[model samples]
Target: MSGADIANVCNEAALIAARHNEESVKLHDFEQAIERVIAGLEKKNKLLSPEEKKVVAYHEAGHAICGWYLEHADPLLKVSIVPRGQGALGYAQYLPPDIFLYTTKKLMDRMTMALGGRVSEELHFSSVTSGF
Candidate 1:
């Protein structure tokens, strides 16, 4: 990793250890630090009604479920609804292969994966959120 990346991860690890009142950081702390730095901290103060929380949960679940069934979409790593990066309410993390070229089917699979969230909202709630 680059210098800045190392610094951020170390700082986050320290924060994680401190949060747990531990004297040393662990592997999972570093892992969580990377996620925290990438996704920003969870919106602790953001108040969502029970229904809204359910929607966000289902929205994230939809992405995972749809991507899981797709043949050519990137392999999903994680999904969350902690509201990271500007207006992002949630996200799906995919592990795309390192390549410079793409096939048409791969592109379409990506499209289907991307649309999964919106489709899920429409199907479940009979309406889509403005965020999707």
Candidate 2:
């Protein structure tokens, strides 16, 4: 990460810790900060129709399922259909493997994991939604 990125994380994590009345910036605070940085803040007030909500839930669940079953895919940390950042309708956080290098199989597994959401939508709804 760059110097600015590290600084941003520290500032955000400290704010999160303070909001929670913690003595120090904790690991979870850092994690939340990182997520906020990467995904933007959770947009809890965003409204979705029931049908859209169902679709988003299914899409995220598809990601979780694929990640869980794929040997080289990262393990899931959490899944949510709650709108996040500017455009994310749903997300599945994974405890990614620490290694930097990716083998061919691992790369393919990652690609499959990414496609899980759309594949799920196709399987359940019989149609794929636009965008990633």
Candidate 3:
């Protein structure tokens, strides 16, 4: 779906939630909505191939490894290459402790950690793959 379509759906969901006497929609509610949308999309049989799965595994591994290496970053909870209900080929789930605030350095470090996978792929494979 397009960004506009997602935005429209989110707006509608917010309206619906509000009409139900919800003071404010939480992040988890929006996340669940997104997951439902993705599940619907996957039911249409749009799944990634083996190569794509490998790339995702590598990408997620990068995130896991980076997070594992950082002291303040979240701990790696799990990493999987198996396709889930939402059609994600892979994912790196983290267990983040309470994050009250973020500093500039912390933000930059997070950004760098996210980029670790792409950088690792480029450095080792010498050929970058697009699905990431």
Output the number of the lDDT-best candidate.
2
lDDT of each: 0.84, 0.87, 0.66
- Ranking of all candidate structures by their TM-score, best first: 1, 2, 3
| Cα distance off (Å), candidate 2, residue 124 | 1.7
| Candidate 3: residue pairs that collide | none
Q: Model 3 off-target regions past 4 Å?
A: 1-48, 85-87
Error of 3 at 112 (Å): 1.6
| Better structure of 2 and 3 per lDDT | 2
lDDT of 2 by residue, 49-112 (tens): 9988988998999889999999999889888787888789989998876798999999999899
Q: Looking at model 1, which ten-residue stretch has the lowest summed lDDT?
A: 81-90
Q: Of models 2 and 3, which has the larger TM-score?
A: 2
Model 3 TM-score on a 0 to 1 scale: 0.55
Q: Give all candidate RMSDs, comma-separated.
A: 2.0, 2.4, 8.2
Off by over 4 Å in 2: 1-3, 20-23, 98-100
lDDT of 3: 0.66
Cα error of candidate 1 at position 30, Å: 1.5
Using all chains and alpha carbons, the TM-scores for the candidates as numbered come to 0.85, 0.80, 0.55
TM-score for candidate 1, residues paired by index: 0.85
Best by TM-score: 1
Better of 1 and 2 by TM-score: 1
Which portions of model 1 miss their true places by more than 4 Å?
A: 1-3
lDDT of 1 by residue, 1-119 (tens): 57998899999999999999998999989989988877777777777788887898888888899889989888999998777766677888888888879999999988888888878
